[model samples]
Target: MNIMSPPPRKLGRIHVPAVTLAHGGGGKAMKDLIDDVFVSAFATDTPRALEDQARFDLAALAAHGDRLAFTTDSFVVDPLFFPGGDIGKLAVFGTVNDLAVGGAKPLYLSCAVVIEEGLKIEELRRVAQSMAAAARRAGVTIVTGDTKVVQRGACDKLFITTTGVGVIPAGVELAIGGIRPGDGILVNGLLGDHGAAILAARGDLALETEIESDCAPLHGLIDAVLKAAPATRTIRDATRGGIATVLNEMAEASGVAIEIDEAATPLREEVRGFCEILGLDPLYLANEGKIVLAVPPAEIQAALAAMRAHPLGACAMLVGHAHAGEQGRVTIQTAFGGKRIVDMLVGEQLPRIC
Candidate 1:
């Protein structure tokens, strides 16, 4: 017996490889890219929701020590560099915040390094060393890692993937769900500082200011807040999508309405002016170090005091509350006293700004 051969289409001239907008678009090309390259190496039992986040079990960590908390994030800022943070510092802080906001004491990280060919060895050393310093500052260890070198231009200078492991005490039953009507909403510090700082570093627009990325590990500050009020239900550090998107998502997930007081939202005088001129909303911009807290009414004052005592949270302020009405939506009482919707950003407002 013999098998018939299938006809073959002639192969087209080799497609010159380049990074393009389509690679980041959540479409056919993006899926193909992830499947062909990234995901195969990082596959897990978890569903690949491809969301800004994913959820997993933390109960197992209770047996290990206390409560289990696990999370992963990857950083791909355009320059592999930025003001106040390179891809390295951002990598560390990103993982740290994820674990801390989940009510875990971040203990370690599994770092995966992908370095493209022709990357400066000095810069590479700097990145690694900076990561070491950052992890140490956060009291975390880089317990294990893998490194890969792709052909030059296959990646943007460098990309870092960090998966973190931590343990929240079992007594802490924090949930984004705990946000309730009349509860206080607060931010640890200023908004838009991190986003604006990175934008200025890009040198795209000539607007000049002393802005800098608010990239910092929040483990200590988070601990401070939790100690004062273990009843603090939900906490998230505004990162890629900014405070606006974060609040919207939190409200939707928790089935509550988040109403923020714009006049109470903290912003540096210069930051506000910059946003007005650039046609940017400070709320829609990214932040690296700040946290948004949903806490009990009685604990509001205590939470704010704990946050402000920390260097990283010196400007903590109450901004809003989760309310009974307007199910799963976020509204801000504008500084003008008018109400407007605050929704998840439809697209990246300031890409590469974090």
Candidate 2:
């Protein structure tokens, strides 16, 4: 008898309309599912050998920069799909922003997904394609990944985890520890868009608006800031806990104080209205595309100019400043000429938001 081999490429549409337990059994069904959905969608200039891991040339990566940056994040946003973006796009850009804010040029990512058994295969393909598009836009590649389908109710409709690696240019320095008194605080765009969008999408509040997630890749904007302000102290993406939580963390980490003008904090009317209606403070909301930067006073204008010149930073504002005072303290000058401490959130404000 003669032995035959599998096809060199498994490029075809998914046969089954929905996932099943067999898909997670690591059998022929699993291979077909992976090939049809993830492999095909993630195709790139790189070879698709479907190896256990991806390999890169050290010399090739070293050409871009000397230091390497690595970060990982998991996405389990409710509704899976929402206005302005979906979980797939969020997973990719979220990790990219992590590496970017660290002053790194994002390069590659690993996408691992867990799908509920009843999920539609088309939905899975849609998410994979979206992730691929986001990676391309961010100038990065999804080089490897894993997939698993759990029993019905074992997992949500889907959950995605992305791990990214980037390279930081030589002569670049940034960290919370670098924060100093009199450093200017700036945000790239409107805050609470993501948090508000998700809240409204869930339909729990019986409220409606046109607010959309501010999800985006920030590496381009970050590069612009670095070029204009090389002495920038630190850059942090305001995610789960929003800008207020980020400021508190920075103050605590650096043993300094952060003071922001509540009047100067930029916000969209829709977001502000949404928060007001729900008694939610926009400061404590999550933001996907915004960053909090601490820049030396002398370089503040340069950094702001560079940011505003970018599409993502068009609404950028000088919201706050670091100062000398009680360690780990954050004070906001209210619009009514009063001051209040902007403390970290005591409990989960909006859970399952990216």
- Tell me the whole-model lDDT of each prediction, alpha carbons only: 0.78, 0.91
Error of 1 at 307 (Å): 1.0
Instruction: Report residue 201 deviation for candidate 2 (angstroms).
Output: 0.8
Please estimate how well model 2 matches the true structure, expressed as its whole-model Cα lDDT.
Answer: 0.91
For candidate 1, lDDT tens digit of each residue in 1-354? Answer: 996645432221212254334544546654554443433333332324343343434554455456568899988887667778888889988999999898888877877767676665557656777787788788887655655667767887788899998888667777877788888998999998888888777777676556778899998898899999778989988988889988987888788998998999999887899889889989988899988989989999999999889998899999998988888888999978799988789987887654
Model 2 residue runs over 4 Å out of place are 1-8, 46-48, 206-208
For residues 1-354, what per-residue lDDT tens digits would candidate 2 score against the true structure? 976644466454557799998998998888888888888778784334577998899998999899999999999999888888999999999999999998999999999999999999888889989998998899999999888889899988999999999999999888988899999999998999999999888877666456899999999999999999999999999999999999999999999999999988999998999888889999999999999999999999999999999999999999988999999999999989999999998889999997
Which portions of model 1 show Cα errors greater than 4 Å?
1-64
lDDT of 1 at 77: 82
Q: Which stretch of 10 consecutive residues in model 1 shows the poorest summed lDDT?
A: 7-16
* TM-score, prediction 2: 0.96
TM-score of each: 0.81, 0.96
RMSD values for the candidates in order, in angstroms, are 11.3, 3.2
C-alpha lDDT (0 to 100) for residue 34 of candidate 1: 41
